[model samples]
Target: MRKYMVTAILVVFAVVTIGTYYVQASQETPPNYKLTTVQGDASLVEGIAVYGNYMIKDSTFGIKRAYITTNGTDYPDEKSAISQSLNRRPMKTQLDQWIEEHRQFMRGKTNTSGFYENEEMLAYVNATVDTKRSNDSSAKRNAKLSISVLNKQKNNTLEITSDINVDHDISDMYVQNVQLIDQQLVAMVFMNHSASGFVSEPQIIRVNLTTKEIKNEPLALPGVKSVAADGDTQYAWLANQNLEHTDQWILRISRNNHRKAYQVDVKTGQISPLTFQGHEMLLNNIMNAYGQKIYFLQKAVSSKENIGFAVISYDLVSKEYETTLKNTHIDLSENITYAFKQDHLYIMGYKNFKGNRLYVFNLTSGNLEYEGKVISTEAANQAEDEANMDLNFIDLGQF
Candidate 1:
């Protein structure tokens, strides 16, 4: 009788432990949405993954990890889990976790444009100004160049400072973009004339990482009075909202709406005008560039249930504009996100708890190569899904 009681107690304890574990696992697992191929080769999107922020109605909820593809080549389920609800478990998305694990040193510093990272080191640049003010013209402003670098191999960080000269009227300086060329740190900066809210003057600043010497170079343009910004207005952005390492930067600078495009060589500081005088076609359109061609979305219309736009492309090699997708405009629903990779354009439409669709376009041939829709494998509670309805994709990459 005593032996039987002990056995029964052990069995009950084991069952309770297993049940508790299952409950925790279910809570951690995100809603499963599988991709279903509707046309062409769906496998083309196996390398692309997108991560986004979720908003329920009006407030911030959490983040969605890298997207799941139909094929097994994308982000693994074990690693890519959605982080939901601030009141619940304080978990981070897969993208955030990856950045933390891989580029741990750049956790807080790389938010702006003045930073460069590679497998060996991560570099950052900024300018610091002294509070002392003087009336004499010869007394240059007390400004210092701030540079920081993290060596991944040695697990060491180096901080350097150098004095920089500026006129008395210059009030502030900001680093826009940074590059490391031949052991030298190059930073594109914007200098404000005063504290007033207005456009800034564009300039190039260079610092020797070893010698800690600072040098200033003036950025000059032809015809266009200013090259401060890339046609970005006070409220709108027209260029591709992505970053990549390049030897040349395309700049659109204009006054009184006569916008003209120019390419600047990062190495030689040479400025050459591009033939694309596309002020009408590029205004208020989302554009991304690949190779010598530029793709843009125009005539974007959004309603309660659907969103669509016309696709157009301009070739720098041929100096010609062409309309993609024939006479048909792309029809998507709710929110849309797109990215360029592997000579293909990947676009997705997702909303609420229900599954959505994916469209792939071959950039070289200008044809729709594949279409896929997401299929929900598991049922979700309607109230919970409603609380997590809205989403905004913030990042895209091959995860």
Candidate 2:
């Protein structure tokens, strides 16, 4: 009887311990969503914009107009669009041929080294002669300063033209960065050529669609390269870090009044330096959405080849550093790229060179999971070619 009682007690204790362990593990694990790459191309993805199921990616080849697919079928064929305010002129047959030749030259034999490696050559070529080409001239003339939205379900495209129309003859200014805030398209324009022989400062401009007017808001920093805003706090964060070095600063600007700008500090600042492991960290990007939260990526200050990336989130209400997304084992060098939409944080990463993968993490659930890779490089290349065929279909004269 004594032996049986002891055995029963041991079994009960074991069961209790196992149950406790499982409960703790479940509580600790965050809920994560799955994101499939669906498609990608090797033509140097310049920018990515996400809206509902529609995703627009701009590349050297052209713009890839695609929609998110959950169960394999594309949403629908969405029409490509350009700015409505843009007055497109009829291109002479000679000019059309010239544009085609230039496009082929850019896509084909031109050295990729010109883009990434040699800045001087790229600057000189793109500035002086390339600007005279038909496509380049059209881009300059149109200056499509607003965001273009494609409705996949309806197979329609909507171009939101910039409210501010300035006839200042600003020829070389290119749209460097764009973000959607409360249905308004905010754009950053910078001079294409670096006159300072180092880096150029970008001008922050905001356009109100309802008012149809443009506001020229120069950034507080003279050499500011990028700007990210937290809508909840009505604060805009600008980074002036050179990619080659870690010397950088984040300026907090009041959205209500662009003139009111200050550096982030311990008391009033939303950012915390403690979240980053490295002293030499440079801010790369910032993403903020309503009720979703704001997150930013910082590259290590050091020049070490193996240094990892850090993701920092800030609480808008408390103005405090909330969490640090750090996993040293995960190599995020070229492996990670993120996009924020609604309540979803889409983190696309690859574990190895053989395959491209994507992971979707829910900020609210704290859940992280691998979604799987949808499109391979070879497949992406084919899709890009198909999209380029429609380039001739659009009547530029209607612009």
Candidate 3:
């Protein structure tokens, strides 16, 4: 009877321990998003273009690779590539001739894909600033920001139907990124006066697609590194780097780059700064602007060299941020590429010397959704060894 009692007690204790272990495991388990990935080109890739669920990437030597959300190969056929080539080539326009005559006008640059497509229309912003110096140390600067629209025909041809240019008084003007927000073409404009001696400020300009009217609101801070918006909730991260003074800049370059993040009000054009913990926020991994939170990867090291990153969240309502994941043992390369879709943030980078790896995180749960290897080839490895290798985001939506 004594032996039997002892055996029964042991069984009960074992059952309790097992139950506790399983409960903890279930609570800590990550979500299953059914994520999958396939091989892209073995050569280096430049940028990515997305058409709904499908993605198009320009591989080495003009080779294009198209894939869906699953990351499987679905190359765009010859006809589609040929059609896009027309847009890719430099089309000689009056703007090009104007740029040639005026060297200052050439300084005002625009993105290659200032054109963004939605609802069968391609919209772009073309900007040029003219600077005329007076005899005394003063100068007169004038800028023109133009909004152009091209209609897509049933035959996949784009024809320019309308163009309207907005006149503004600014020393230098450039269109950084144009986004279609709330049925309007909103452009993130970088403008400054030459006397100011730096990029003065970042402006949010909204264009009425139908009426060709333009209205703008300026951000409080200069050096806007990145900006993302979703409906009314918008935010911009500022990275104040003096490209002129590389040495003094390098003193605080890594730490000062993303030192501040701000919540932007689309209606009022007002910006309020947010307090966050880490400093080295990776600008490339910033996902699309969600409702009231910004999701991004930040790397904070004890010294100047640690490259490990931590995931963090900034709440637009509270205007504060808390680190969701502590710095992991995983080391990340400076060349990181990322994209956000659904509720997942997908990232790719060199996992130390283990070659390039792709990872995804659940923005809602703050759990790592998936991590896998992106097959690297010999040529890609050689190219990456070069000094100028860079990781470019293939603007999934902008193309």
Cα lDDT listed for each candidate: 0.58, 0.36, 0.45
Which ranges in model 2 have alpha carbons more than 4 Å from their true place? 1-171, 175-188, 193-199, 204-215, 222-293, 298-310, 328-335, 348-356, 373-399
- Top candidate (TM-score): 1
- Write model 2 residue lDDT over 161-264, tens digit each, in one string: 44343222233454433334343444445533222122223455554545656565654443233222232223333332211111122343333333222233
**Candidate 3: how large is its RMSD?**
22.7
Residues 1-399 of candidate 1: C-alpha lDDT, one tens digit per residue? 999999999999999888765565445545554456888985675544334332222223334443444531122323434423322111243335436755755565533566676788777787767767677745778788878888878978888878877766467777767777778877777665443223455677877778877788877756543222444321112132223455555555544445555566667778877655754647446566655666766544445344465567877667788766432345564556776664577776556423445677886677789876555455555345334433334233322
Model 3 bad stretches (over 4 Å): 1-121, 131-138, 150-171, 177-185, 194-196, 209-211, 216-259, 276-289, 300-308, 318-327, 333-343, 348-352, 374-399
Could you tell me the C-alpha RMSD of candidate 1 in Å? Answer: 11.8
Worst 10 residues of 3 by lDDT: 242-251
Candidate 2 — worst ten consecutive residues by lDDT sum? 120-129
Model with the higher TM-score, candidate 2 or 3 = 3
Most accurate candidate by lDDT: 1
Better of 1 and 3 by lDDT: 1
Q: How many clashing pairs per prediction, in order?
A: 0, 5, 1
Model 1 steric clash total: 0
Q: How does each model score on TM-score? A: 0.59, 0.35, 0.48
Cα RMSD, model 2: 24.4
Model 1 misplaced regions, further than 4 Å: 1-108, 117-121, 127-144, 149-158, 165-174, 191-194, 209-211, 222-243, 254-258, 275-280, 300-329, 332-344, 348-355, 367-391, 397-399
TM-score of structure candidate 1:
0.59
**lDDT measured at residue 284 in model 2 versus the true structure, 0 to 100:** 33
